[model samples]
Target: MADLEAKPPLSPSSTLEKQFEDFRHHLEESESLRERIRAVAREIESVTRLIYSCLLLVHQSRPIPEVLEKVKAQISKLKELFHRLAGILRECPGQYYRYHGDWRSETQTVVSLLGFMHWLETGNLLMHTQVEERLGLKTSEFGLDIEDYLIGICFMSNELPRYVVNQVTAGDYDCPRKVLKFLTDLHAAFRMLNLRNDLLRKKFDGMKYDLRRVEEVYYDVKIRGLTANGDSTRDLGIQGQS
Candidate 1:
């Protein structure tokens, strides 16, 4: 009996139990955070769809100003959602990438829409910093991924082909030439970057098709002798607004 008593009872190890308890609490907190992030991301995605629907009106030959007016409200909503995302990410202080995948698709979509909108509003490539500013995402903590920005730009490029086609159909003959010029310059600019991402590279390759489509449309317009003779600054481009 003394031997058993001296050996002590077979109680659980307080140290091990405390460590496991800490781990469980950590996992619970992490799950809660992820759920919050996902909620904000879902809202972001919803707003993106709303903005995209408004942008489609442009393809339907709707007036640019009218489409923009509808999009403006959604932009305000996206800013709020992104702000909420940034706030939630601050909970961990230094783990932005840990949860980045949660909103990756939504953010990419947002950037694409914003890039297209910026092009319509200003006729310039939407810079990364500009996107950050537009979304109110400029925090010292963490922010938009560069790959997401590049991918979004590629997505924006995909829209130009369709826009140019519709523009010519709408009797805006010079639209093709201006789009061709813009795409040429944009493609040249992309060539300067040493992009290593497979997805981004694939998307960039697709821009060539966009450029080709625009080129074909421009040549068709040129052959038909229907090109506009204005100073080339009245459509799709906001002078001095970039």
Candidate 2:
């Protein structure tokens, strides 16, 4: 009977205060997650830059074996960073796409660099599955985005024309034929996808120019009889622009 004193039916004001507190807690948690994602993204960007620098050594005309050796450390670092990214994402399960933009550009760069390296070593395009395996992304939750992979392949294509030009200038006339074939195949493969993404479409468009440039170089070498089997094979060793 003493306890029957009404507890004021839980005042409306008190109910509102409880609701406000819940909202504040959720807001704080959301901010915390955003901050954490940003921090991880920055770290990923840094490691990606290092990986890019290693890939740049390829442009220096260093032997592929040596370039691969130098990049091995950076590639390992990148894998670790990706693992860290995956860990952070696990904290918010089922929201991989939600935070994907945070690291989208860097992931594309990584894919481009890795794809280029793989091509150098094996004379083939790096498959998406191989990229996932290299990055230790064994789960669907954090697997490489297909669009990013395709875009990265486009970026890799951009590198080849320059590489071919450089190799030709360095007296490697055979380089253009090899690079032209690669770019031609890559461009055709990219055309197979029905890309709705504007950025991807733009990048693919640029690939056409790259293919044309490489083709021009290949024709120059071919028509001038500068190939290894041609009359100017000896003169082909002279360094000059394509």
Candidate 3:
């Protein structure tokens, strides 16, 4: 008698249709956004595999200066692709809101997605410190500044929790609508990240407390829990450069 509340997952066809419908509605606001989304989707379909491979390498490798170099190279490649994508969008018009609506907004969206992935990448590094230390390496000397890395992590971690907040609290029609579609796409990427390595989700969960702090700072949202510190970071045994 307890079988009345199950929900079904969205079929692939339904997902595409919903995305297109949202695009059409958003296009009514700016044709450029519609065009840019299509362009980026095409690029994503083509380059996602490469990005995944790089991400996997970053996640799975032991800490060494060379590995950090490789990670930096991968990040540079990601940024180059994003910039090229943005150049295509800029050929149309206006500043990409990265936070608001318009044709250029797609760059901001892509940046945020990349940022989240990067943040997780770093968090993984910190979480695995003992492994790196065992190899006689210091993760911090990868040669990145705190502000730059922190901002990227903050931006990336913000995406989902912010999406959650927008769904429940925001009154802005356009912003919420855009965020919903972006959130769906981000989750799809998250699923791909999970599939690439069965252990990622488990490892990710082990660092959830740290990630939550990132999400909080990114969205300027607060939670009622003590922030993880000291042995909290060490107990996880994740290597951190800082």
After superposition on all C-alphas, the RMSD of every candidate to the true structure, in Å, is: 5.8, 5.7, 23.2
What's the ranking of the predictions by lDDT, best on top?
Answer: 1, 2, 3
Candidate 3 lDDT, tens digit per residue, 1-242? Answer: 34556667799999999999999877675666555656655554445445444544433333334444554444444445445545554644543334122212333233334554534445222212332232232333221222333233324444444433443343322322233334333333344443343343443343343344333432332232222222133332323311
Q: Which structure is stronger by lDDT: 2 or 3?
A: 2
lDDT per model, in order?
Answer: 0.86, 0.82, 0.40
What's the TM for model 3? Answer: 0.30
Q: Which residue pairs does candidate 1 place in steric collision?
A: none
lDDT of 1 by residue, 1-242 (tens): 77866955445797688889999999999999999999999888888888998899999999998999989988889999998988888878889989999999899999999999989888889999999999888757667899999899999999999999999999998788777778877887788999898999999999988988887888788778797654333442423221
lDDT score, residue 47, model 3?
52
lDDT of 2 by residue, 1-242 (tens): 66797565668999999999999998898778877877877887887777777777777787889888888778777788888888888888898887788888988988898899899998899999999999988667689999999888888888888888888887888988777667766777777889799999999999888888887888798897887674342242322322
- Model 3 local distance difference test score: 0.40
Off by over 4 Å in 2: 1-20, 228-242
TM-score of 1: 0.86
Model 1 spans > 4 angstroms off: 1-21, 228-242
By lDDT, the best candidate is 1
